[model samples]
Target chain A: MVEELIIAGFGGQGVMVMGQILSYAGMHEGKNVSWIPSYGPEMRGGTANCSVVVSDEPIASPIVTEPTTAIVMNRPSLDRFEPMVQPGGLLIYNSSLIDRAPERTDIRVIAVPANELGEEVGSDKVANMVVLGAYIKARGTVSFETVGQCLAEVLPARRHDLIPLNLEALKRGAELVK
Target chain B: MAGRKLFKGNEAVAEAAIRAGCRFFFGYPITPQNEIPEYMSRRLPEVGGTFVQAESEVAAINMVYGAAGAGARVMTSSSSPGISLKQEGISYLAGAQLPCLIVNMVRGGPGLGGIAPAQSDYFQATKGGGHGDYRLIVYAPASVQEMVDLTLGAYDVAERYRIPVMILGDGVLGQMMEPVSFPEGSEPENAPQRPEPEWATRGARGGRAPRIVSSIYLKPEELYKHNLRLQEQFKRAEAAETRYEEVRTDDAEVLLVAYGTTSRVCRSAVEKLRTAGVRAGLFRPITVSPFPYKALGERARQVKAVLTVEMSLGQMVDDVRIAVAGAAPVDFLGTTGGVVPKAADIVERAAALARHGAADQATREGIS
Candidate 1:
């Protein structure tokens, strides 16, 4: 099955890095995956999003119009991408930042307090990872162990010590969904 | 299978260039492709290679010409407007028969367009962005993996024919990340050394004659002869290197022709069309210059109609028309100014074309 997702938030929210980590985990599972960022001026404080496609077969367009899943970490991202989610798919939002819930009734909506959970896990910088953890746990998209391995690869050697905090954030968020 | 690694397209291209033994890179910064030079700057030095952040695109191309003349594997990259500035140098490189790589991560344009993905440069890339009937063997990659693979392949093709080659991508492909793998031992340290050309401008030493690397053919006859030789090389490339992919073309009632990022959208549209019980296929040109016209023309005979899709306002469509050659009517759908065409819209339009006949050329313009 193909899981096409759009992960969007403010530029510093690690939206692009979240997409990369998930795509890297997909690769570990022998899945064909692609991560396409909405780069350019959006790299500033503007809303940044990236389309992540993980599939058993070769992925077609890296540009996702109606994604099977939408992860909105901020209000603007929800306002923009909420309508683009496919019916009977999934919508995961960070309730810590977004006050309103997704209005789509056909799709399953999961509200995780990613920022709060991230702070509880020791830092708010990994709020994106918290949301990612919930999505993977709620959807079983990839295993937590695989994500751990991917984090090792994604982080630089100097920053490897932060893996424990990131793992804690991931586990904390995953626990909420569980 | 080799271990999979995540790579942004621009970074992947840099890695591939290094693996292909490219030792010199000269380029100016531009949006949608700045990562290419940035990656080169960080990595080339580690490999004992040179990366020159030239003053301008014009200087960068001349630097490429210089490095290529010295028999070093070299490359330069730019966006659409910057590419135009290098046209004169490109023509000279072709005339001098210097093998080099030029990458254009195309952005929307006729002028200084937005920093978004576009295939608008199709005409400029395939029909000689430079003057004097020179063609850069253009390879349009549809994915990040292809971005790396075709980059390695482009060097071989350029060196084989001693002509400049291009790997045409857009902002989408340049900025995207994907799992890419290279063959074992494909890294620069493990790859075979690129053999130096005998005609290189090595300085006179020991009893050897000095070579002149020049494009100035003063006499009309000499210039004509040089052009003919280039044409012969082009003819050989057309015969031997035309690359394309036919997806579900057998028993297809309608065919969608596209390349680069547009082709990826077309593939999604084809899947949607099939689900709707519309028999559709996708024809993607991997090599835009040695266009798979003959192959597509033969396939056109079976399909009821052809719908050419592009990010540009119908540039490659003209070639599709020439290739179809009245065997099947050709239609077009596109957007300009950095708006990417949607797959759902492509499916709807392609299905309509399959039901009705191909629209006339004038009417086709209306569809865009």
Candidate 2:
């Protein structure tokens, strides 16, 4: 089965990084994977997004017009992407930034107070990890252990000192579903 | 050997150059192609190679000229406008018969166009970018993995031909991430060492005088002979290097011809046509110059019609017409200024061409 996900937000919100982490984990698990970002001026201060496809078969188009899952980090992202999520798909939104809830009943909407969770975990930057945690808990496309390992490999390369805090944020967010 | 790693196309090209034994890189920063220089900056030093961000594209390409003159495997990269600035240097390198790799990760253009991907530079690349009769072997890569493979092949072709080669790609191909295999072993041992240039400005040895390399020939006859020699080299390249791919064209009634990213779109179009029971196929030219004329000419003799798709208004379409040589009717479909045509549009265009062909045949029968 093909599992397609889109991560979108402002340029600096780590939305692209979240997609990269998932793509890395998918590759690490030996699944066929592809990561494609919108290039050119769209990547400036404007909204930016990336499509990640993980599948048992070869991927046809790396550009996903309809995604099965979406992680919206901001209000603009939610408004832009909410209509494109497939039926019965999952959407994890950062409720701290996105004030409106999704209007659709055909999909699963998980609103995580990602920024507040990050603040509770001692950093506001780990909000992406919090949203990622809620996504895993909701969909189970990838195991929490694999995501943790991906986090260990990718996060330290960018921010070595924030790993433990980000890990804590992930666990806290994941436990919210339980 | 079986593992995967995430890499942008620009980074993949840089790494592939290193694996191909390119020891010197000179480039300036420009949108879409900046990653190439950045990758070279971080990776060159680790490999004990040289990477320099020159002050301008002009300077960068001349530095490539200097390095290539010294018998070193070298490369230079830029985007559309920057590549225009380097045209003079490229022409000189071509005139001097220097072997080097030049990369253009193309962005939209005319002036300082937006940083979106475009294929508008096809004419500049395939038709001798500068004011001379010289040609650089130009390769258009569709994906990030082919970006690596083509970059490596470009260097090898340049060395083999003793002429400059260009890797012509769009920004989407430059920025997308894909898995690439890092080739095993150190650099190949059998590459021809840069010949000691009697024409290079190497430091004077003992009593020997410094050498000079220039393309300026004042005498009209002398310059004419130089042009003829360049033409001869181009002919050799034409005979030796035409690379292309023909997909399911055996019984194809309509040929969807394209290159680079446009070729990928045409592949999807062909699949759509197939599902609809239309006999459509794709012909993709990997080497733009050394233009694959013979292959297209042969296909034209068999196909009823050909549709040329490109991101530009119709640059390669002109080449396609020339290749077909009146053997078949050639049609053109294109998008410009960074707009990419969707697969559905291409398929629809192909279907229209098929209907037009059938109508034309019916008219011929009515006349008979």
- Highest lDDT scorer: 1
In terms of docking quality, model 1 is medium
Model 1 chain B: weakest 10-residue lDDT segment is: B356-365
What would the per-residue lDDT of candidate 2 be over residues A1-178, giving only the tens digit for each residue?
6788999988877888788888777777777777877764665468888888887665544556568998898899899899999899888888998888889899988889999998998987888888888777777767777777777666656686677787788787888775
Query: How do the residues B151-188 of candidate 1 rate in per-residue lDDT, one tens digit apiece?
Result: 88877899888889998999999998988888778877
Model 1, residue B359: distance off in Å is 11
Whose TM-score is greatest here? 1
Separate clash counts for every candidate: 0, 0
Model 2, B1-368: lDDT tens digits are 15467788889888888878788999989988888999899888877789998889999999999998877789999999999999999999998888899999888888998787789999999999998888889999887778877777776688677789999998777877866666555343434455564555667788897666668889999999988988888888889888999988999999989987778778767877999988998999999988999899999888778999988888999999999998778999998888777787888888987888777666766953
- lDDT of prediction 1: 0.90
Candidate 2 regions exceeding 4 Å error are A40-46, A66-68, A83-92, A103-113, A116-124, A134-143, A156-161, A164-178, B186-212, B365-368
TM-score of each: 0.96, 0.88
